[model samples]
Every structure is written in C-alpha cells, then in structure tokens.
Target chain A: MRDQNRQFRLAKRPEGKPDHDTFDLVETDVPDPGPGEALVRTRYLSVDPYMRGRMSAGESYADPWEVGDPLRGGVVGEVVESNGAGFEAGDIVTGDLQWADYATAPGTALRAVDPDLGPVSTALGVLGMPGRTAYFGVREVAEPGPSDTFVVTGAAGAVGSVAGQIASLAGARVVGFAGSAEKVAFLEDELGFDAGIDYSATDDYGAALDEAAPDGVDAYFDNVGGPITDAVFDRLNVDARVAVCGQISLYNATERPTGPRKLPGLVSKRARVEGFLVGDFAPRFEAATERLAEWVASGDLQYRETVTEGLESAPDAFLGLFEGENVGKQLVRVSEPDE
Target chain B: MRDQNRQFRLAKRPEGKPDHDTFDLVETDVPDPGPGEALVRTRYLSVDPYMRGRMSAGESYADPWEVGDPLRGGVVGEVVESNGAGFEAGDIVTGDLQWADYATAPGTALRAVDPDLGPVSTALGVLGMPGRTAYFGVREVAEPGPSDTFVVTGAAGAVGSVAGQIASLAGARVVGFAGSAEKVAFLEDELGFDAGIDYSATDDYGAALDEAAPDGVDAYFDNVGGPITDAVFDRLNVDARVAVCGQISLYNATERPTGPRKLPGLVSKRARVEGFLVGDFAPRFEAATERLAEWVASGDLQYRETVTEGLESAPDAFLGLFEGENVGKQLVRVSEPDE
Candidate 1:
C-alpha cells in the first residue's frame, strides 16, 4: 500500500467555468483509520455535474467546499484497513469520500459493493446514486403515464439516460434531447427511446420538439437547463410534470442568467415543476438499488461509462461534464481492484 | 323592462393593453328565451384579471375570444322569464354571461345565488371564483403546515386576499405583498397577515422579505408574477411549495419578458411550483365555496370590493386590475334588483 496519498483541493471559488487554477493537487500522508473507521483505496471516483455546485460559496443541497478543503464525492474502493469496524481487508465498498487515492471514513457511512451487480465500478453509476435518482424521480416525481410523452434533456448523461429508459419501461413514449447525433443514436437505438433530437443541430428547440414530441411534452426530466428548458416550457401539455434533476448548463454561470419567464406559462398548463436531490431518498436506497440491479441483470436496462485514466484526470473529467464531453457516467479510475 | 340590450363586443385583439378601440358597444333587441332557457337581466358584472388572457389571440386554459364576439364573463342577474327551466321569474342567479343588460341562457348553465350568503355580489367575490381559487390553491397545492412561513403576492387582490388568510388560519406566519400602504394595511390589519410589504414602496423586494420573512418562505401563493415572485423565490426555504394563482403583471406584455432563472434555485431548496385554475377543481367547487362562505360568516375571513357604478365602466374596471387598482374584487353594477 502506498504511504502517500494525492488529493484535489478547492483552490478558490470559481467565477464562472472552472479552469485548471480552480483545483490544486497535493501529496499528503495517507489518513489513518481511527476507531470504527476504515481506510479505503479508491478504485473509481465519481465525477458528476452536481459537484460543481459545491465549489461555490453559495448555499445548495450539499454544503459548499471551502478553499483548501479536500473535494469530496462518491467513491468506489477496496478497504485496505479496518479498525473495529464491520469490514474485512480487501472488501469492496462505496461511500462519499475525498477526491483522492485513499480516504478514511466511518464504516457506518460505507456500503458493501456487490461485485455481482455488473462491475464493482458500477457502484458509482448504474447500481448507485444516479440509478436510484432516476428511479425515484421517474416513479415518484415525473409519474409518466402510458399515453404520456416523456421528454428528457441531457439524454446521454448518467442520470438522464436511466430516467428516459425508466419512463420508456413505464410504457410512455420517451423522447430525448442530446448534444450529438451519436448520443441521439444511443438513446433511440439502444435505450428504446421513441425519438431523439440533436439540440446542437438546431437553435430552434421548439421546432425540434414539434417534430420529436408532436403531441407535446407531458413529462419532462430536465438534466440540462437554458434555452432547451424554455422550449420545453413552451410546448408543455396540460397537467405536465417536470422533474428538475440537474441544471448542468448553469452551474458555472458567473451571474444569474435571465430567461423568458416560465411561471406564468405554468398557470395555463396547470403544470408542476419540482426540484429534488437523490440523498433525500437515502432511506430507500437499498430497495431502489436492488430494483436497478434486477433490471440491469435482465437486460432491461443498459449503461455506458466514460472513464478518465487516472486520479490526476478527475478535474478534467468533471470539467468535461459542462462541455458535454462524456457520453454516459463520467468516472475517474484511480486504481484496479485486486484479483 | 328594458327593450334594448347594450353589449360589449371584442372588436380586435389587443397588442398590449386593451383600449376603447378593442371593444365596440352596440345596442340591439333583447333575444327571446329559447326552450329550456331563461331571460336574465344583468345585475352585477364581474371584472377579473383572468379575463385578460381570453382577450389575446394566443391559446390559454380558457378559450380565447375571436374578434366580433360579445364579451362574456361572470355575472349575477335576476331571471325575468323561464321557458320550462328550473327557475322562478324573480330568482337571483349567477353564470358565465354576456356583458350586456340582458342575456338568455339554458337554466342548466346557471346557478342560483343565495342572497343569504352575505350580499348577492359576494357570489362574484368572496363566495365565487376568486374565493374558490384561494381555497383549492392553499389547501391542496401550497399545503402550508402549522410551522410554515407563507408569503403571498397581490395580497390585497381578490384571490390573494383570501389565500393569505387561509394560510394564516392554517397556523402559518403569513406575509403579504401589496401595491399601496392602504392595501398593505388591509392585508395586515383586516386580513390578519403577520406582515405586509408594499411592493410599490420599494424596488428591493428581497430586502423587504429579509426583514419580514427572516426565517425564509415555506409556502408561497403567487398572484402577481413579476419581480415580487422573483424575490420570494430567492428567499424560499427547503421543501417550499409555490402555488401559482395568477400573473396579472404579464397579461398585457406584447412579448415574453425575461427574468432570472428560478428552476435552478429550486434544486437546492427541493421546492415545488405548481399552477392551477379554480375550474380544474370544479367537482369540489360547491364544497370549497361552502367552506369559504363559512369562514366569511364566522368572521374568520374579511373581504373588500371596488365596484364601478355602471356597466359602461366594465372595460375600465378590468384594465384597473393590471394597474393594481382594485383592492379586493372588482365588479360593475349593471342594474339594481327590484324590491
């Protein structure tokens, strides 16, 4: 085991889009596991769009990361050492941990990663937070009916891909908005999405929606916000439901971006727009994860991963989320699990 | 009995605010009652903000008025003649009727207005559409709890006045935003709102809210959806619920106005914003109206009205709504009931 650990720290609050200067990588002594704690070597670090919110000083669902504090997110790792905790050495686990090669966390915070659930790395993707988010967001919030037209933005991203598929499984006509033709192809050809629109190809999203969602959008899962959302709001059918899962488009905005007022439009449609966090459903995580695994095992659900090669690539991987550079779940591979 | 009927017809769609040119007053012979219909002499004409949406060429929850159609709205009238319909000659009734001295309609489309429910005009204000809007919006959509901090915009207006009081009755701290010091006094003094912000007194709604709703807003009932709503969105606490009741501010806008995006903020707060029309709760309207009437009868609720003396003033009364001219319900007294 390495005696030294490398971790990324928040260098400063970003003004807009985070650049290389926003993060500082430093070498430090590996944290020792205290009583009821475990020392885990990270195999895969989850790089998500939501992490960008933590880099700011403003209040959000998760507490902001202060300058010089180690950046933290979901990590799938192998436990190397345990101190009076319910875990054995070499056990695969996942928890909210520092963006580093190694992290020490209370054993109570960690969950055993079932290797049988596809790949161990999936503990950070399909069988994990993103998957559970899609499950609850679709079932509880969006509630797309069989005759409903379900529209999702960022169709190729981690949570959105699963959300569209889940809506499709519910017998709704699922339409997705993706940045590229390849992502559009993935949604329609692989995920069984009824239709897909390449938003990058047209500035007039309303026209694109007119073609893909001819009947108008009844349920919308918004992972990206901006003009795309404006267009969706314009075409909302009566009694529509919008689950605001993420706003990757506005995370790095230096100032609040102004858009056409939407609340007024809601009155005519009698629609609902709700924002939620997956952590709010932690109590049901186990049951939801099991359901997700069952789908994956049955070939009813599929997922792709864009893995960055090393821990040093974590910042780049995260920045790529805003750039639409990753196709599916963006993960930073820190190490390989022991055979 | 009057031999001539004076009616207002939509001459053309307004580009911004409707003016005298938009409506043409015409005098015509009163139509005889058809089978199963009654001839009703207009007594009171209800002028409301929602009417503005119907004047546009664009589609809305209510069907738009085509050019050259007689302007129609809520009206309280006395049945002069019944043709095998369920009404006596002297019965006071209310229904969607024309803005004319007399209108003939099937008795099935009209509801008898009980004079025992305060004055007959109350059927157009506190005991009518506006009151029922407040009832369902607060009880079903906003759902304020005992510990909640409720904020309402257009607090002295018809729907908002009742909404704030209902939230207060639910044991929530109610703060209201109104246009004038007098309206603020009506909200805080007469309606029992905990605090009132005169929006016309300051441009900084957020600063005013910081003082009035220091703990942050938990439930919001929005009637005037512009800067006032933007301020409330900024101060929303976690799990906030926003009930979008009306948007009088934007009813006359020739083009959509832009404002700071609010959905992104909903993510951090896990808030829900829903829009509703009172008509959507039609099945429950009778029960809801009874509850509202009970509140008014018990002196738990208070109401005000700004009545125009003549039907000739109907267009002006409606235009007044956009200017924040009415304190509570705005109505035009078209004729007097016989003793």
Candidate 2:
C-alpha cells in the first residue's frame, strides 16, 4: 500500500461549470487513527452532481467547500487501523469522508456494512443515501396512489431510477425523462417504466410529456429542474404532488434562471410541492434500507454504476455527471477490497 | 321592487384589463320561481378579484364566463317569493347567483343566514367565503405553530386580513405586507399584526422582510404573488409552510411573468408550498364558521369592507380590487332588506 495519501482540494470557486482548474490533487502523509477513530482505506468514493454546488460561492444545501480544503463525500472503505471499540481491522464500513485514497473518521460516524447484503458497494448506491432519498421522497412526499401516472426527471439517475421503481411498485404508471436513448431504453426495457422520453432528442417537452402522460401527471418526482419541470407543472392533475429532490440542471448555472410562473397552476389544481433532504430521514434509515435490500434481493429494484478506476479520476467522474455520462451512481474506485 | 331584472353580461373578453365595454347591462322581465326554487331579491353582491379570471379566455379555478352571458357571484338576498319547501318569503339567504337586483335560484343552493350573526353582511365579509378561506388556509394549509413568525402578503385585503388574524390567534408573530399606509395601520392597529410593511413604499422587499422577521419566516400566506413573494421565499426557515391562497397580483398580467427560481431552496430547508381554495374545506365549513364567529364575538377578530353602494358599480368594484382601491372585501350593496 502507498504510504502517502492523495486527495482533491477545491482550488477555486467556479463561475459556472467546473473544470480541472477547480481542483488541485495533493499528496500528504497517510492519516493515523486517534482515540475513538478508525483509519479507513477507501475502496470507492461517490461523485455526485450535488458536489458541484459546494464548488460555488453561493447558498446551497451544504456549506460551500472553501478554497484549499479537501473535498468530502460518501466513501465505502475497509478499516485498516482502529483505536475504537466495536470496529476492528478488516471491517467494511461506509461514511461521509474526504475524497482520498485513505481517510480517518470517528468510528461512530462509520456504519459497518455486511458484504453478504449483496456487494458492499451497494451501500453507496441502492442501499444508501440515494436509495433512502428515493424511498422517502416517493412514498411520503409524492404519495402516488394506484393507477396514478408518475413522472420522474433524471429518471436514469441514482435517486430518480429508484424513485421510479418505488412508484411502479405502488401500482402507478411510471414515466421517465432521461438524457440519452440508451438511458431511456434502460428505464423502459430493464426497469419496467411504462414510457421514457429522451429529453435531449425532444424539442417540445410539453408535447412529449402530453403524449407520455395523456391523462395528466398525478405525481412528479423532480431530480432535475429547468424547462422539463415547467412542462410537468403545466400537465399536473388536480391535487398532484411534486417532490423536489434535486435541481441538478441549475447547479452549474452562473445565475438563477427564471421560467414560467407555476404558482397559478398550483392554486387552480390545489396541488402541493415540497423539498426534502435524505438527512431529514435519518431516524427512518434502517426501515428504508431493509425495504430497499428486499427489493434488490427480489430483483424488483435494479441499479447501474459508472465508475472510474483511481483517485486521479475522481474529478473527471464528477464533471462527467453534468455531461450525462453517468446512467446511475457515479463513483471513483481507489482500490480493490480484500476478498 | 323593480319588475325588470338588470344584470351585467360579458360583452367581450378583454385583451389585458376589462373595461366598461367588457360588460353590457341588459334588462329582462323578472320571471317567477319554479317549484323548489326561490325568487331572491339581491341585497349584497360580491365583486371579487377572482371574478376577473372568469372574464378571461384562460384556464382558472372556475369556468370561463361565455360571451353575452350574465356574470354570477356570491349574492346575499331576501327570499321575496318561495315555491320551495324549506324556505319562506322574507327568509335571508345567500347563494351563488347572477349579479342582478333580482334572480331566481334553487332553494337547495341558498343557505339561510341568521341576521343575528353580527350583521348578515358579515356573512359576505368576515362570516363568509373570505373568512372561511382564511380559516382553512391558516389552520390546515399553512399550519403555523405557536411562536412561529408568520408573514402574509395582501395583508389588508379580505382573505389576507382574516388570515393574518388567524395566524395571530394561533400565537404566531404576525407580519403583514399591504399596499398603503392606511391598510398597514389597519393590520397593525386594529388587526393586532405584530408588524406591517407597506410594500408600495418599500424598494427592497428582501430588506424589509428581513427587518420584520429577524429570525425567519416560519409560515407564509401568499395572497399576492409577485416580487414580494420572491423575497419572502428567501427568508423561509427550515420546514417552513407556505399557503398560496391567491395570486391577485398576477390576475391581470397580460403575459406570463417569469421570476427567480425557488425550488432549490426547498431541498435545503425541506419547506412545503401548497395551493388551496375555500371550496376544498366545504365538509368542515360549519366548524370553521363556528370558530370564526366565536373569535369575532370575543373581539379577537376584526374585519373591514369597501362596499360599493349599487349593483351597477359591481364591475368597477371588482376592477378596483386589481387596482388596490379596496382595503378589505369589495362588495356592492345592491339593496337593503326590509326590517
């Protein structure tokens, strides 16, 4: 194992879309686990679209990443050294940590992952934050009833993909809006989505949405916000529920983009729109994880991952999320775990 | 009583704002009530901002008024003649009826109003649709908790005045945004609002709102939608509730206006925004009326009305609502009932 740890730091705030200059990869002495801490060898580091928000000097869900600070995110790792109780060497764990080859964290922050629960990496994808986000957002926020038409933007993405499946399980007709034809096919053919619209190929989103949701959208799970969300708002049925999970489309915008006013329609339809975070559902995480695992075990839920091999590729992997290069969760594999 | 019924008919749809030409006052011979119907001599006719929507060719909460058809609205009248079982001549009743001195309605549509409920006109003001709208909107939709900083726009208007009072009664710190200093004084002095901002005098709404709500806005009742709403959205606390009762500010917009995007804030704060109509609370209207009456009886609730004296002034009264000419509920007193 390398004696030096390599990590990416926010070098500067980006005006819009971030590039290589936004990050600076630095090497340092491998961190040591202090009392009640564990030294983790990161096997996978999550590269999410939300990370883009932290790279800007603006208000976001999380505090902005200060220039010269190492970036942080969800990391699935194996404990190499420990000075804490309940955690031993070779234990596989997951927690929010630095995007580095190795990270040291409080043992309490790291939750042990059972490899037998179908691949430890699933802890960062379908069995983790993204999965729980989909579960709570769809089941609680959107509340799609049977025979309802559910439309989800960013449908081929981690949270959106899972959200669509949850809507389908609830006996609703699920429709998805994805960026590419391959992603659209993945949603319709592999995931049992009733219909999938390739937003990249469609000029008239309103017309495409009308064709997909002929009866009107009963629930909308919005993972991306822009013109697509505007169209969905226009097609909402009376009492329609909208769950605003993310606005990845605007994360990289230089300025706030205004669109058609939506409040008028909400009043006429008596509809509801809400925004939520996964951290808010921490108390119910165990329940959601159990259900998601069962779905995955029964082949009722499926997931895809786009991974780049090495800590050096983490920046590119994260930037690729904006370019629609990822179908599901984007992660960077720093090393292979011990079998 | 007059032998001919005079009513306003939709002459044509207005391009932007309806003018005198938009209405044609037509006269016809008064007809006798059929079996199970009552001939109601109109006393007070409601001319509200929502009536402006029916005159347009766009979709709204209610159906559009067709060309050459008499406009209909809430009318408090005396049963001049009854061919119905439950109603007697001279019975005071209120129902949705044509804007005329006299019109016939099914007895079932007319609800008998007690003259003892602090003036029967209170049925059209504090004891009526506007009152019930504020009741359900504050209690159910916004759900303001005690000690919450509640902010309401169009705060001196009919529904807003009541909504602010309801929030104050719920033990919240109420702040109001009104169009004039007199209206602001009405909210702060008579209605017990903690603070009132005359939006017309303020150039920076965000700064004004911040000064009023030093902590943050926990609940927002939006009766007017425009730049003022955009500013309140910026100061929303975590888990804030927004009740969108009306968008009177946008009722006469010639074109759809685009404002700053607000969905991104929802994800971080986990806020909820819902639109509602008073009709949605029909099942519990009796309970709301009782509570509202108790409040008014206790002198804890107060209201004001800008009454236009004749039925011929109904069009101008409604148009005045859009112009911010009326302070509270705008009603035309068509006639006085025989004591």
Candidate 3:
C-alpha cells in the first residue's frame, strides 16, 4: 500500500469559470479505515459538469464543497483494506469519494462493481449515475414514443450520449446538437442518430433545429441550456416533454442571464419541463443497472472515456469539460487496481 | 327584437396594446338560425387575457383571429330563436360567439345554462373555462398537498383567483400576488387565501414571496409570467410543481421579452413546470363543474366579476385586462336577460 496520498481540495469558490487557483493539491498520509469502513485505493476519479455547480457558493441539490474540503464525486476504486463485514480486500467498488489516491468510506455507502461487466470504471459512467439519469429521463420524464423525434443537446457528453442512444433504441428519430463536426459525426455515424447539428456553427439555431427535426420536437433531453435550448422550445410539438438534466451552458454565468421567455411556448405546445437527479431513482438503480449492462454487453450501447493520465491533471481535466475538450465520460486515473 | 346587431371586427393586429384602431364597430342585420343552429340575444361577453394571444397572427392553442373577422369569445345569451332540438324561447345558453348583440351558433356548440344551480353568467366565469383551468392546474398539474405552501401569481385575475381558492380549500396554505392593495385584500379577506402580496407595491417580488411563504413554495401556479416568475424560481423547494397557466404580463410585448433562465432552479428542486389549457380537460369537464358548483354553494369557492356595462365597452374591457383593471373575472354585460 502507498504510504503517501495525493488529494485535491477546494481552495476557493469560483465566481465564474473555475481556474487552477480554485483547487489545491496536497500530500497527506493515506487514510486508515475506521470501524464499519473500508479504505479504497482509487483507480479512476470521475470529473463531471455538475461538479462545477458544487464549486460555487450557493444552493444545489448536492452539498457544496466548502473551501479546504476535499472535492467529492463518483470514484471507482478497489477495497485494499477492510474493517467492515461483506467487503473483502480486492473487491472493486464505487461511491461518492474524495479526490484522493486513497478514500475511506463507510462500507454501507460503497456498492460492489463486478469486473466481468465490462471495465469497472463503467460503474462511474454507463451502468451508473449518468446511465441511470439517461434511462429515467428518457423513459419517465420525456417518454418518447415510436416515430417521435427526440432532440438532445450536449449530444457527445456523458449523459447526453447515453440519453440519445436510449431514445434511438426506443424507435424514435434522434437528432442531436453537439459542439463540433467530429462530435456531430460520432452521434450520427456511430450512435444511429437520424441527424446531428453543429450548434457552434449555426447562427439561427431555431432554423437549424427546424431543418434537422422537420416533424418538430416531441421529446427534448437538454444537457446544455442556452440559445440551443431556446431554439428547441420554439419548435416543441403539442404535448412535448423536456427533461432538464443539465444546464452546463449557464453554470458559469456571474449573474442571471435571460433568454426568450419560454412559458408562452410551453402553453401553446401543452408541454412539460422537469429537472431531475439520478439519486431520485435510488430504489430502481439495480434494475436500471441490469438493463444498462445488458445493452453494453449486447453492443447495443457504446461509451468512450477521455482519460487524463495522472492525479495532478484532475483540475485541467475538469476545466476541459466547459471548453468541450472531452468526448464521453471524462475521468482522472489516480492508480491501477491490484489484481 | 332589435333588427340591427352591433359587432366588433378586428381591423388590424395591434403592435403592442390593442386600441380603437385595432377594432372597428360594425352594424349588421341579425341572421336567422339554420338547422342545428340557434339565434341568441347576447347577455354577457367574457373578455379574458387569452384573447390577447388570438389577436396576434401567430401560433397559439387558440386559433388566431384574422383581419375582417368578428371578435369571438365565451358568451352567455338567451335563446330568442331556434331551429334545433330542445328548442325553447328565453332559455339561457352559453357558447363561443362573436362580439355582437345577436349571434347564431350550432345548437350543439351551445350548452343550456341551469340558472337554478347558479347565475347563468357563471357559464362564462367561475363555472366555465377559468374555473376549469384552476381546477385542473391545482389537481392535475400542481397537485398540491394539504400542508404545502401554494403560491400563485396573478392571484386576483380570472384563473389565478380560482386557483388560489381551490388550493386553499384543498387544505394547502395559499399565498397570492396581485397588482393592487384592494385585490390583495380581496384575495385574503374575501377569498380565504392564507396570504396576499400586492406586487405593484413591492419591487422585490422574491422577498415578498419569501416573507409570505416562509416554509418555501411547494406548488406555484404562474399566471402573469415575467420577473414574478423569475422570483418564484429562486425559492422552489424539492419536488415543487409549477402550473404555467398564463403569461399575461408579456402578452402585449411587441418583441419576445427575455427574463432570467430558470431551468437550474428545477434541477436543485427536482421540480416540474407544465402548461395547459382548459380545453384539454373537455372529457372531464362535467365532473370538474359539479365539484366546483358544490364548492361555490358551500362558500368555499366564492367568485367576483368586474363588469363593463355596454357592448361598445367590450374592446375597452379586453384592453383593461392588460392594465390589470379588472379585479376578478372581466365581462361585458351587453344586455340583460328577460326574467
């Protein structure tokens, strides 16, 4: 076991986009597991867009990480030392853990991940929180029907990619809006999406969306909210459903930004907009995981990871999310799991 | 019977607020009813905020009124002449009719008003579209819990007034925001609302809303959408439900107005916002009306009307809706019913 542990702690609350100054890396002794806890050796640390929300000093569903506290998010690690029952050494697990080489968590909080079910890192991506978010948002919130047109923003991101794939599998014509031509090509060429629009290249987003979704949008999975979302609202068909999964576009705004008033459009379309978190579906997590695993195994669903090589690169990896630098799930590899 | 009928025709679509130039008063010969039709003497003409949407050439759930077309709205009239089944002179009936002293409509489009239950004019007010709107909004969309703090904007207007009353009777603590001090008093003192804020008297709507709903808002019934809506979005509690019933505040804007982006609030609260029209509830109208009538009879759902006395005052009555002139349901009393 490594005697020294590397940790990234929140140093300051960012007013807008976070910089290197927002986080501080410190070296400390590896944490020892207390009673009913297990010491996990980190393999991969998940960097997500929602983590930006926690970096700000405000109300969020997830508790804000105060300055001097270690940043916490989805982490897949191996149980190297155990002081609790049912958790044996060498067992792979995932949980909301500190960004450290070693994290000690209550045994009850960590869920075991089977290595045979693809790479265990997937427990942090697909077959995990992002997967469940896409599953529930598409099925429960959006409820896309066969022949319906499903439009997803942030189409190449972790959650948006999974959401688009699921909607396509449900027999809906899927149209996606991504940042680049490459991401757009990935959505249409690899994911069976009916069409993909490079939102960054378009000035008239509504017209672009209208051309892509000629029948109008029946279900919208919004991960990036801004002009793209505004355009989607204008083209919503009657009884449309919008799942407000993320608003990465407006997360860094120093003050409230305004767009075209959308309630009027909602009334005309008789639409519904709902925002949700994966934790809201805790009871059905196992069921969702099983279905997601089946899809991954059957080659029906595919995922990519933009991996940063070291613990020191975590800040750059996270910041890259805002710049649209990463494709699919972004992760920081802290160490390799023991066989 | 008068041979000449006074009609208001759409002369031009107004740029902002409609004026005399937008409406042209015309004199026409009263037409006889054809088969399955009835010629009725107009009694009360309903002037509502939604009519403003129809005046514009755009997409709305309600079809837009074209130039040279007579203004049509919900009207309660006495059947003076009939050419259909269940024909009877002096029968009070209600249907969507033109802004004229006398009009002809298919008998099937008109429903006989049972005066014994309540005022026949209620077929256009509390027991009609607005009431049904409030009913479904609270029960179907907002779904307020007995102990929840239910906040409603435009609380003194037609739909908001009834929405507040219904939420209050459902055992929710109802708080309202209105345009004037008198309307605030009308909501709290006369209508059984738990609290009321005169939005016109306060610049900080969020502060006023917070003071009234100290426990945080569980359900918000939005009618006049704008900054008031922006304020409510800031304080939404977990699983909050918002029923988007109207955007009367922005109805007169020549251009699409931009306000604060609100999807982030929904994410933190796991909230829902849905838009609906009463026409969507046609299949359940009978059940809703019966329940509403019982509430009215029991004094649990009292209503008030702001009546303009002449047919010539119809356009002024509608324009007054934008100015927040009418306290409750605004109507034009074209003529009196024969007792």
Candidate with maximal DockQ: 1
Worst 10 residues of 3 chain B by lDDT: B81-90
What would the per-residue lDDT of candidate 1 be over residues A1-339, giving only the tens digit for each residue?
A: 787999999999889999899999999999999999999999999999888888998888888999999999999999999996689999999999999999999999999998877898889888889989899999989899999999999889899899999998899999999999999999989988999999889999999999988999999999999999999999999999999999888888888899999988999899999999888998999999999999999999999999999999999999999989988799999998652
Candidate 3, TM-score of its B chain: 0.98
Find the 10 residues in a row with the least total lDDT in model 3 chain A.
A330-339
Q: Write model 2 residue lDDT over B1-339, tens digit each, in one string.
A: 887889889999988878889988988878789998999999999987788889997999999999999999998989989996379988999999999989999988999998887778878878999999999999998988897999999899889999999998899999999999999899889999999999989789999988999999999999888899999999999999999998988887899978989898888889999999899889998888888999999999998888998889988898888888998888899997653
Q: Mind giving the per-residue lDDT tens digits that candidate 1 earns over B188-266?
A: 8899999999999999999999999999999999988888899999999999999998888888889888899999999
Tens-digit lDDT track for model 3 on B222-317? 998898988888888899999999888898899889988888778878899999888888999989999999999988898999999989999899
In order, what lDDT does every prediction score? 0.92, 0.91, 0.90
- Report the Cα lDDT for candidate 2: 0.91
Q: Which residue pairs collide in model 2, if any?
A: none
The list of candidate 3 runs beyond 4 A from truth reads none
DockQ of each: 0.90, 0.88, 0.86
Q: How accurate is candidate 3 locally (lDDT)?
A: 0.90
Query: Candidates' TM-scores?
Result: 0.99, 0.99, 0.98
Clashing residue pairs in candidate 1 (N, C-alpha, C atoms within 3 angstroms)? none
> How do all the candidates rank in terms of DockQ, highest first?
1, 2, 3
List model 3 lDDT by residue over A209-327, tens digit each: 87899999999999999889988988899999999999999999998888888888888788999998888899999999999999999989988888998889999999999999888
